[model samples]
Target: MTTTGTSSSDTTATGAARPGGPGQLAGRTVSRVGFGAMQLERLRGDRRGALALLRRAVELGVDHVDTAHFYGNSFVNGLLREALRPEDGVLVVSKVGADPDPGGRIPLRPAQRPEELRASVEDNLKSLGVDQVPVVNLRRLDSGPGLRAEGDQAVDIDDQLAAMTAMRDEGMIGAIGLSSVTAEGLRRAIPAGIVCVQNAYSLVARDDETMVEMCAAEGIAWVPYFPLGGAFPGIPKVTEEPAVLAAAQSLGSTPSQVGLAWLLQHSPNTLLIPGTADPGHLEANIAVGAITLDEATVASLDAVPSRSADVRIG
Candidate 1:
């Protein structure tokens, strides 16, 4: 399970002063460890608690935030608008191409039509109270229920990239990103240019490892959405697995901390945007940036078996 080319300098922690140690994201220098606004609206109906959490994260030197208009049905972005000032120095990365209904139901269908993309970006600007979003990822539609592997299916992202490229040309977006994509999809979209890729990846889920390598080689930031393995409830839990538990016990760290450290060591280009609603949980997650795993531990964790059929390492 030992990564081949990882070095000590590449494993810098993201503390309040360091903040990922001069890492660059989307051509913008930002913290390698960032915040995700997905669960902010789910904090037991505590809006102020959520706002306080955002401000606290920034105070801890988190300069990058992953969010979307559909997150909490645009509620999270509105909260961000209140928490962040235009000169807060935080890069708010939002997404388009998926429109949650007013009630915020499941199965967010794709809305990548050119007109729909324009409207979606406009909605994000209005909700976040920003003139221009730093980055906008075009999320691809899933072919089925759970995460589909790159080998399972392929999606054409040419049109989607073209639309986003137009927006970038118009100065509406700072950079372009892709989500839920396969290697083939990235290949199709790369000609138009991309700055980042946000995919579902974790210690247990190595499906997108090749994509991670590709991003590394191309100097594109690899932003993994579910680095902690919480996106799919039905999938096997990484923290509960025997290998992770043993490593946590041996290292005197929590399972969540061990999991995140694995991601930071997995690749230098790997940037984490782990999400949480509780302030305590947020602090705990930030501290994960400081945990360093030994090679033996990495091998042990890598040997952990995948219990879900969704394991797509191809």
Candidate 2:
């Protein structure tokens, strides 16, 4: 799994330029099998390990990497800057809105005012060592009883859009996107030229299927946050299902590979940003692109029970 000397020209069975080859991002194209840099923070381990993982991901042909100013006191972006050169074909997308607390707990906060938003974008530019980010998602206020009670105190969607539009016009961000959004939120943002949507989606959390379909129909890229359920770590439940297991057995691949393959086959608009702090795990996740499920296997996987109803909106 160590990618100390690997080049981008290494070919796979599909003969694609790279894993999950260039996908549309706000009309621009980037790799579909993107890397999520959340684990680059010193969340529960050494920061050096996280930095190495970022370098390893780039070496593995993951051209798209997602992060946020809120991740690890913004240290994760710095780590990415240290590992990746700006000229590499990397599309770094970051979100704004939440800030880390003293204890490292992240809580949803009101969107910054127009001037503050501009400053925040500038701060992200400095930390990530980039003049302009490929995509910037306006992390929305988390929906729940407390936020609901806050009511009018929350940043108005119109105001948020106004600020984002200004950023887009200024060329600070190449495209606009939304995270943790609802159908209504999307309806409001779509008119403002949203090109991407990020939400918690996996076999165990399918609540955003409607949004996924909408993005597909609109030709917007839908990047799922947790392709693997957060509740069950390390266990490949989605790929262990009877249908997937059979496919994996036939293909001689792991369950995780089958799961990711199924996801890619399910929707052309789908882009996965699976996160990992380990180089071996990152390589394994990227290699999932080699597994292709047959039509019958895909249909059987579609018939599997969905957790769409159990996902909590908060």
Candidate 3:
């Protein structure tokens, strides 16, 4: 995979764009390198910085931008809308479900009543400042164990599909996606022609390996939300891995870049949405697209020891 684009103003802040991989979403060609908008809130009080990164993303040729109403109280979507022109050929993918309460807590369980799903879609459209979002993922609860525990019945896949189909028919969303889904869950949802699947996958995380392969075989885009791992404290950073460090040193690239390149090479259908608040880091993230790993290097990096499976996301 190779990306083609000149460095933007934020290039120095991070790095340059690498070659990009190929993927099609709703019949539109998209670069596998996507901007994750979770960092927009870090610049909330400093809107200028957030806007700059958003604009820089477009200028850098990032066609896909991921956000969610549940992120930063829906401020991230608004910032995205404010930063880019309406017809700039950017694909905005937002997730619904897990509406946080006033206390800023996402329920351990999901509540996707038909009416609730409808309202969530409407709110997402309004918050995103677009009549139709390129993709809307129905986020499932991060529960453990049994299928019933994951809120499978809370929002039936058929019901969700019906809602998404209605939105697509109404031109409110171009495609539908699913996040945090299990193999069984995805099997149930597959009939909907899910365009994408966002799950926690990285060099250290392979919980979604089967699902990722399934998406690849089906020509559906597989989006790894935490391609570099979660932002929370105590989580292992991809940059800290010995393999990533060595690769970065050999290529004169950053660890983040190496981590992302590893993911791009992991699967043709894989798309990464690594998020960063600093313009420099964002540019560096995009530049990872340029780094290529030789077969030996790819094997060595793939052999790096990962943390225990106990750390896996539910």
Candidate 4:
């Protein structure tokens, strides 16, 4: 298994400042810096290692985890079911709108239709052995880092929400969130009580700056996906930035830590789900919530400017 930089003792020594800190999310308090389970895809062959990695993250005081039924075609969810315990109190968040493209060239195929999304939720519930999901992010595939909706996959936001609302009413899901959606779509979903929004966002990818602000204004958790960009178009590598590297050197921390710290400091409502199977990296990512950047350093990093690119859905 693995973790970020700070050890459990190191985090405890500065618990107030570290412990990956907690923030409000859908009426529940969860770590501001949580874990994303995508990286576990490769660890499937090593079940023990995968379980330990997930357990290690929880031990580091991570109380939030972003996952999806489509990830590894639900293989990751099986790991979560085995690794996480009820007393852990981890707010396991899942997303719908794509099904695993099993035996296909692509990793995922669009499942944007309302019924498909409902089926994905059912898959999550069964795979995780949970009766009701805490929060389910409806992934609108009008845009992509992965799959995009075309043909029959092009479904309206209102219709997708209708299905989600029905499930929520039946106690099938605790809360609802949006993923890969637009400002206009978010605005329309206000009455639906969206608890969060997930999009490809980071220090360099500021195209969603306005939307982040919008979420903040409305008290919605802006749970950005690729906070430390990974081969996404127009999103630069945070580790490669001179300012980030210099800051990391000065702070005596890794560039990845600084990059993640910037995200925590970027907005009050922001929550992180940077994922990794490597223990050191996991601990480093969680430790980011504790690393505070000085105003000068933050300004320098900010000056790097947002390389806005089109990743939109209306």
Candidate maximizing lDDT: 4
Q: Where does model 3 exceed 4 Å of error?
A: 1-21, 105-109, 142-153, 230-235, 306-314
Local error of candidate 4 at residue 188 (angstroms) = 0.7
On TM-score, the stronger of 1 and 2 is 1
Compared with the true structure, all predictions reach lDDT values of: 0.75, 0.70, 0.72, 0.82
**Candidate no. 2 TM-score:** 0.83
How many clashing pairs does model 2 include?
Answer: 0
Candidate 2: where is the Cα deviation over 4 Å?
A: 1-16, 42-48, 104-119, 142-153, 232-242, 309-314
Please identify which of the two predictions, 3 or 4, would achieve the higher lDDT against the true structure: 4
* Root-mean-square deviation of every model: 6.3, 5.3, 5.4, 4.8
Question: Which ranges of candidate 4 are over 4 A from the true structure?
Answer: 1-18, 309-314
- Native-vs-model 4 lDDT? 0.82
Scored by Cα lDDT, where does model 1 land?
Answer: 0.75
* C-alpha TM-score for every candidate: 0.87, 0.83, 0.85, 0.92
Model number with the top TM-score: 4
Q: State residue 244's C-alpha deviation in candidate 3, in Å.
A: 1.6
Q: For model 1, give the 10-residue run with minimal summed lDDT.
A: 1-10
* Better structure of 1 and 4 per TM-score: 4
Count steric clashes of candidate 3.
11
Runs with alpha carbons beyond 4 Å of true place in candidate 1: 1-15, 103-107, 142-155, 306-314
